[model samples]
Structure formats: C-alpha cells, structure tokens
Target: MTKLTCFKAYDIRGRLGDELNADIVYRIGRAFGQFLKPTTIVVGGDVRLTSKELKSAVTNGLLDSGVNVIDLGEVGTEEIYFATSFLKADGGIEVTASHNPMDYNGLKLVREGSRPISADTGLADIQRLAEENNFPAVTQRGVYKQQSVLGEYVEHLLSYINLDNLKPMKLVINSGNGAAGHVIDAIEAQFKARRVPVEFIKVHNNPDGTFPHGIPNPLLHENRQDTIDAVLANKADMGIAFDGDFDRCFLFDETAQFIEGYYIVGLLGQAFLQKHKGAKIIYDPRLIWNTIKLVEENGGEAVMSKSGHSFIKEKMRAIDAIYGGEMSAHHYFRDFNYCDSGMIPWLLVMELVCTTGKTLGQLVNDSIDTYPSPGEINSKLADAKTAIARVRAAYEKDAVSVDETDGISIEYPTWRFNLRSSNTEPVVRLNLETRGDKKLMTEKTEEILALLRQ
Candidate 1:
C-alpha cells in the first residue's frame, strides 16, 4: 500500500505525483465510496491539467464500489455543491487545489446536502480505508454520466440577488486564466438578457492550467495590482477577482482600493440581515472583525466558529445560519447547500451597491476604518509550537483574555492577535486587528514577531 502524506485535517492536497497520483486517487475514490456508501455521487474538476486524469481514477474507484458517478466536467467547486443538492446526490467531490501553486492539486469532499467531510467527520474513515488497500467488492459496477450544470448554477446564484433595480455600472473582472472564465460567460449572458447595464472589462479571462497571468490568488499583495490597474484604466465602478477554482473572490472599490474581506463580510452580513431579520450569521475568529458588531447592532445574532472551509460549513449547518463568511474571502450561502461560493459573493455585493446607490468603496470604508487589521502575515519558523508558546508567554500577563480555539488568540481592550500553525506547511500565520489603532497594531505585530524569533 502506498502511503499518502498530503491528507491533512480536512482535504487532500499536495504536489502532483509526489503526494497524489492517478493510482492513489483511484484508491481514494474506492475509500470514499466505501466510507460514505452513497447511491449517487457528483464529481467535478477544475482546469488543472491533472484534474481530468485524477477524476477518471476517482470515478473508477467509486464504480468498483457500486456507487454511480455524475460527472460535471471542468466546473468550479461550488457547481459541484449545487449539483449535489439540486440533483439530490448522496455525496460529491470537487477535484481542486483551490488557490495553491500550479504544481499542486487535490480533492474537496462532501456528503448529502453538500455537507463537508472533514478530519473530524468522515475523512479519517476514508484515510483508513485508503491505507488498508481493501475496498468493498460489488457484483455490478455503477454507471458514469456527463452533464453541464453551469446554466442552472447561474440561475440559482441569481436567485440570491435582486436583478430588477440593478443600475448601470462598468466593472473590471480578472479571471486570472482560471476556472472562472467558463462560467462568467453564462453569468454575463443572463445579465445581458436582463439588461443590467453592467459592462464587464475582462482580463486574463481564459481557462488555462498553466496560469499565464500567474496564480489566481488575490490575497497576495503583488497579485492584486493587475486587477486594480484595470479598474482604474477602465474607470469601472469595482473590480472582482477569483482564486484558482473560483471558490472564493476578492474585490476592489471604484478607486481600485482593495476591499478587505473582513469589511465585505460585514457588508454582506448587513445585507442578509436586512431581509432575514434576526437571522444567525457565522464567522471565523481569525481577526477581531467588526462584522460581529455590525451584525449585533442590526438585531442579528453573531456566532464565531473556527476558521477553515470545513469547520465553517459544518457550523453553518448545525446552527441553521443564514450566512457564513471567513476573513479569507470564502462566503458560504444557506441556499448553496451552505458551501462556499466564489462566484456569488461578488454578484451580491454588486446588487448591494446598485440597490443602495452606494459604491463598493462607500459600503466598506466605514468598517475598514472602524477595525483596521494588520493583514495575515506568514513566517517560516524553525518550530511553530515553540514560537507560538514563546509569544503566548510574553503576552499572557497583559492579555485580558486568551483562547486557543484555532490557535493562541490573545485579546487586549484595544487590539487582538491570533497566531496559528499552518496545516499544510512549516509556517505560522499571524492575524492582528485593532479598534481603530493602526500604530498599536503595527507595534504589537512587530513585538510578537520579535518575541517569536527570540
């Protein structure tokens, strides 16, 4: 039996061939089928060169275990979630590495209603089944069928936003040559039919596994400038960018100022609460988000969950929350099976701007000012645990509160910071935020880094 190194606490991801391959993926399919015992499974893949081959291997394994596969080829991750719930599939899997580097690819799995399958869920069972190399035998193999769910997906997404009163606007969209381009055409077709009066200036809007415009991740400061430049040059109202699989999106205002995901969370939370008063909203505790304050102020309940896609989705389902958002730009919808949709966040934000007669900049500016954040910083530490412990000891005395839900989150009256070890690499991630105090945030960030180094 071949060993798998990249099976993390949640999904399976690693450099191609070294940690994942056709044979191992085949075994994973059998393992997943054996674990879930689903009658029908929805499978989809991104534009990565390896995705098709991996999907084939996974399908064979599922068939061998007597589980029928509905293949939605070359679709985004959220589309699989849409198909699973719409088609009433027993489970689903999306073959994607998300915004990881070009050399890596992997799988995101879920069960009925698009519920996530994580380490605490069925991932451990799948891992055990894969490691044992013994899959369930069946008398007959299940069938495979190919379908395109993009049209239905677009319609489903539009249902969340009011298209009736959307005003005339020009927007810049950079797909980064990822999987988003294929579906953007469908969405644009619908917008045109409805006469939304929005002109889309597209850049790098092609599905290329080679990533000619570099990786599609906008969280990196250097990668966001192209979209910002396009927005400024075209004089567009806003700019939207997608990650590799288009499962998360990042936005820039009319002036090309990058709108932080934290502010977007608050903005979207407010939008949702307007219609569903007193609805529950879930957020991750990576930063001291003013989104919680905004939600509470608006007569809605705010619940904090641990970070990560799997954790947020699970909590959303458990609490029956109306919306769930992460500071990293992942927004999960109750309608979209509570799975994160990189496509819908921007659409809803556009609707918010159009209906409210405010620019994206105006909607987020106040919140950004209220809770300034240091932005996530990653450090390649010699030992993550030791570094975290040293920082914790240094701040323990002054911290008004300390919690290790995700990592070491130390809170002071004016500022707070969360330092957690990365699941996939030997690095520690630090996220700090303040109550309108930028200098203090910077000073405390430096102080924590210095202590970690010592």
Candidate 2:
C-alpha cells in the first residue's frame, strides 16, 4: 500500500503537487464513494487556484464509482454542509485547504445530514482504502450536474435575522480575497431586494485564489490589521473577516478593536438565549468561564465539549444545543444542520446591534471586562506531553478543579487556564483567563509559560 501523509486528525490537508494532487484526490474520491456507497454526493471547493481542477478530478472519480454528484462551484466549506443537508444528499466533500499557504490544498468530508467524517468517524477507513488504490469495476458511471445553491443559502441566512429590524448600518466586510466574497455579494443583493437597510464597505472583495492580500486567516494577529484599519477608516458599525473557506469568521468592534473569539462565543450565546431562554449552548473547554457565565445568566444551560468541529457538532446534536462555539472562532448552529457558518454569526450580531442600539464594542465589552483572557498562546517543544504534564503537576495542587475533556483544564477561585497539546504538531497551547483582573491574567499566563518552557 502506498503511504499517505495528508490525512490528519480531523481532515485531509497537505502541500499541493507533492502530497495532494489530482491522482491522489481521485483515489480519495473513489475510496469515499466505495466506503459510504452513497447514491448522491455534494462536492464543492474554495478559491484556491488548484481547487477547481482537483474538484473536477474528485467528481470524476465519484462518477466513475456510479455515485451521482452535485457540483457546487467554488464555495465556502459551510456551503457543502448546507447543500448536503439542504439537498438531502447522502454525502458531501469540500475541496479546500482553508487559510493554508498557496501551495496546499485538501478536503473536508461529511456523511448524511452533514455529520463530520473525522479520523475516528470513517476518515481512517477512507484513508486506508485510498492508500490501497484498489477498486472494483462498475458497469455504469454516475451522472453529474452543476447547481447553484447561493440563492437558497442567502434566504436561509436571512432567516436568522429580523428583516424589519435590521436597521441601515454601515459595515466593513473584508473577504481577504477568498471564497467568502460571492456569498457576501449574494446576501447584500438579498438585502437590497428585500429593501432591508445595510451598507457594505467591501475590502478585497474579489475571489482571488492567489490571495492578493494574504490567506484569509484573521486568526493570525498579523493578518488582522487590514480589517481593523478598514473598519476604522470607514467608520463602520462593525467589521467581519473570514478564513479562506469562510467557515470561520473573526469580528472587530466599531472602534476597530479586534474582539477575542472567546468573548464572541459569549456574545453569540447571549443572542441565541434571547429567543430560547432555556436552550443548551455548547462551548469548547479551552476558555469556558465567559460563555458559561453568559449562558447561565440568560437562563440557558452551558455544556463544555472538546474543541474541534466534529466534537462540538456531535455534542450539540447530542444535547439538542441551540448553538456551539469555539474560542478559535468556529460557530455551529443547530438550524444550519449543526454546521458552522461564517455568515450567520455576523448577521445575528448585526441584528443585536440594531435592536439594542449598541455598538459591537458595547455588546461584548462587559464580557471582556468580566473575563480577561490572554488569548491562546503556543510553545514548541521537543516533548509536548512532558510540557503539558509539567504544567498539570505544577497547578494540580492549587487548582480547585481540573477537567480533561480535551486537555488539562485547571481552575482556581478567581482564575483558570487550559494547557492543551496540538493535534497536528509538537506544541503545547496555553489559554489563561481570570475573573475581572487583567493583571492576574497576565501574571498567570507568564507563570504558566515559565512552567511549560521548563
């Protein structure tokens, strides 16, 4: 069997040409078809230059396996999820590297109802089958057709907000030259068609696979300044930026201060609680106090799940949670088939701003003040486990509580931190949060880092 290194804990991603080319992707498509034996599958890709050809190759493989394919041309990852469930397709695949460098490309797969196909959930089986590169001959080939889901997708997104109350607001939207621009354009047109007031100041709005600005990853501190600068220059009510595939979005307040994803989790949770007071809200275990406090304060239940889309989505479905959020900026909605959408979050926040007459800053300022966090910090070491063990041992004595759902989370009376090892690298991630004390948060962050480094 030919060894393949592209498969990760969650999805398939690797450098282009060398690790993931048309031939390899074709085999993956065949393997996926063979493994699931689905009658119909949905396929889509991001704005990467190679995505089109790769998607075509994969679609051909699916067709060769006698599996019907619905091609959603050049879309965000969430679109595949939306189309899969919305079309009632048996399976789906998205050809996207999502914020990786230009030289990389990969896939994200989901089974029926858009349930994630992670390493534990049939991805490994598909990987092994692809590595074997063996397939049985089929007498007939499946059919293929190109379908546009943008109109329906826009209507679904609009369903999340009250059209009447979405007051005319000036907003700066930066697409980072990724696949998000098309959807934004569609939504803007929908707003205009409905006569709902919304003014969009678009930046890098074109879908450029070359990523003229940079890869659309606002998670990196360096890539955020452009969006922040645009928001301030335009004097917009708020700014939203999305990753290459647009499944994850980062927000900035009217003042152009980049809001942490941890706080956004709380903000969005509160927004949902307004309509469904007793609903359940799932959050990652990395940074919990803010989300937990907000959900509880609003007469909702807060449940903590391990970080990662598969786990978050699974927990959300299990508990019938209305929403799930990760501090890394992935927001999942039950209404969206338990899939995360970059579009839904900003719209909800916009509605909140219009209805409450509050700036984005005002909405999340209290959460930021109440739970100050030294956003996720990382350290590369020869032995990540040893580093995590060191931190756990050091804090085990003083911690009032410890949870190991995803990583080692140690809680104190007024402060807490979660030290987790990366799934893809030999590095440890540290996130520290304190109850209304920036000084203590800073001190604990450094103190924990010192121990992690030791």
| Candidate 2 structure lDDT | 0.92
Where is the poorest 10-residue window by lDDT in model 2?
419-428
Give the clashing pairs for model 2: none
lDDT of 1 by residue, 1-454 (tens): 6668768888899889779889889989999988898999999999898899999999999999899999999988888889999999999999999889888999999899888888899898898889889765668899999988788889898898888868899989999888899888888989999888888899899899988778889988888989999999999999999998898899999999998788888888989998899999998888755988989988899999999888888788899999999888989898888889988898889989998899898888887778888788889988888889888888889889998789889999999999998876788999899999888888988998888876
lDDT of each: 0.88, 0.92
lDDT of 2 by residue, 1-454 (tens): 7799999999999998879999999999999999999999999999899999999999988998999999999999999999999999999999999988889999999999999999999999999999999999977999999998888988888898889988888889999999999999988888889898899999999999989887889988889988889888889999999999999888999999998899989989999999887999999988999898889999999998999998899989889999999999999999999999998999999999999999999999998999999798989988888888888888899779999998899999999999888886667889889999999998889888988887
| Stretches > 4 Å off in candidate 1 | 136-138
lDDT of 1 at 264: 84
Q: How close is candidate 2 to the true structure, as a TM-score?
A: 0.98
